[model samples]
Target: MQLTNRSKQVSNKEMTLAEKMYLPAIVGGLAITISHFFRKKPTIQYPEVKKYLGPIYRGHHILKRDEQGRERCTACGLCAVACPAEAISMVAAERKKGEENLYREEKYAAVYEINMLRCIFCGLCEEACPKQAVYLRHDLMVPVFQERDEVIYGKDRLVENMNDRYIRVANSEVQATPTEPSLTRAAT
Candidate 1:
């Protein structure tokens, strides 16, 4: 047995000669094309005129340093472990005597690398860092490389300089706060 709903059936009737000609459809399409032709273009002259990326825009990653210009990374492997893509890898080394100027902690990352091709840049590594040593910065741009090996950033590439913008911001924040004594000022 078949069930019927008494609904109105859609007509599949053949089109008339005028409808088959599609004159209205053609005219409507041409009208749209003509309207767009006179419209103002949204094209940007890139490299000459830069678009503003708002604050909190995440870009390339950088390993941060303490106010004393010492490496903040303890080599705890938290950033590597938190990475969903498994792009991060590092080797921890014990900070030797007189190396206190170089590393903030007893253990430091002797070898730290991040594979750009593998990294999703989800900012998980930045969030997972307990020491605030790793961060995805807005200013820096990660450039394209020819070689796959070139994409894998070592400490030399990943580590930011002492006068880095992020480090300056951190220093300013610490100095601005009344409760916090500026380590950079205290050291000097």
Candidate 2:
């Protein structure tokens, strides 16, 4: 006494010898395995062939430098706080009177370091930086490391080189110019 009209028809008929052997099911599985042999493999060979990373792909982190080649990080600790993985650490040092050309701000990061092994490359540090000093490079990726000691990147590796400046694609021309315009009083 079924109450629902959606009940499926049940087969109570005895199965044939070939049907019980499950030869059809076995043949279907074998056919699927053989068909995959002719298909293209999606594996990529590294080192010799680099993968095409998209424009927004976040890679190695960098501490940016101003147009004058002065370190822009002010040791505000905003980036360190924003890092969810707690991979970034830094020590602030007061800029000396004679080192005006080296740092953009009075306070600068003296010991900035990021553990590549712990870092998730989430780019939160870049967003949290008010000075726009911290940025994840889109063009370059962190190299393969066999030893754990090499994964920890210090200020020397994070600092942008003045001779070979890293330029963002969206602001290639803009980055080449000065960060701000000179505001002077006009002669009345």
Candidate 3:
């Protein structure tokens, strides 16, 4: 087998005294620096003037509730299984007879947690949820934390309040079957 040399040849011209001294290169660098000094800066005043994030931007995760104020998660473990980073974990428990008002399903998550450090914010958990119980909130971003433990979000932190604007926005997009007659009327 023969190898072909497809390389281009260049002429090696002798450098002038000024070129050899690198005076042209120095002047070129100075010209670039001076141009940048006069040019408009593309800087945002972070604290005072916030940059706007688009509507589809995914951020913090939230455990949603039904219209009746009951937890929609059935502790199916689907979210944990679907998470590529293995950031989610939950303990399942059977709902008590009197706890129907607290849980939407017979099985409920006794404990649910997500390690934010391990999460890639890919929205896989939200997509895996069949009940539409989990959502990655577009309005809220995950806050910076100093300690490792502070990044681990428990049910208390993940659960969205009924009055929360983000939760209301999320719920409005989800078409859930009305559990109550009043909710059915309101939807109509």
TM-score of each: 0.69, 0.69, 0.68
Positional deviation of residue 167's Cα in model 3 after best superposition, in angstroms? 4.7
Q: Could you tell me the TM-score of candidate 2?
A: 0.69
**Cα lDDT listed for each candidate:** 0.78, 0.81, 0.80
lDDT of 2 by residue, 15-119 (tens): 988789999879988999999989988665444444445456688788999999999999999988999999999999999998999999899988999999999
**Tens-digit lDDT track of model 1 for 136-156:** 875445776899779989999
| Per-residue accuracy of model 3 over 3-61 as CA lDDT, tens digit each | 66876669689988998999899999999999999998877554444443445557888
- Alpha-carbon error at 143 in model 3, in Å? 0.8
Off by over 4 Å in 3: 1-40, 165-188
**Best-fitting candidate, scored by TM-score:** 1
Total clashing residue pairs per candidate?
0, 0, 0
Error of 3 at 54 (Å): 1.0
- On the 0 to 100 scale, the lDDT of residue 51 in model 2 is 47
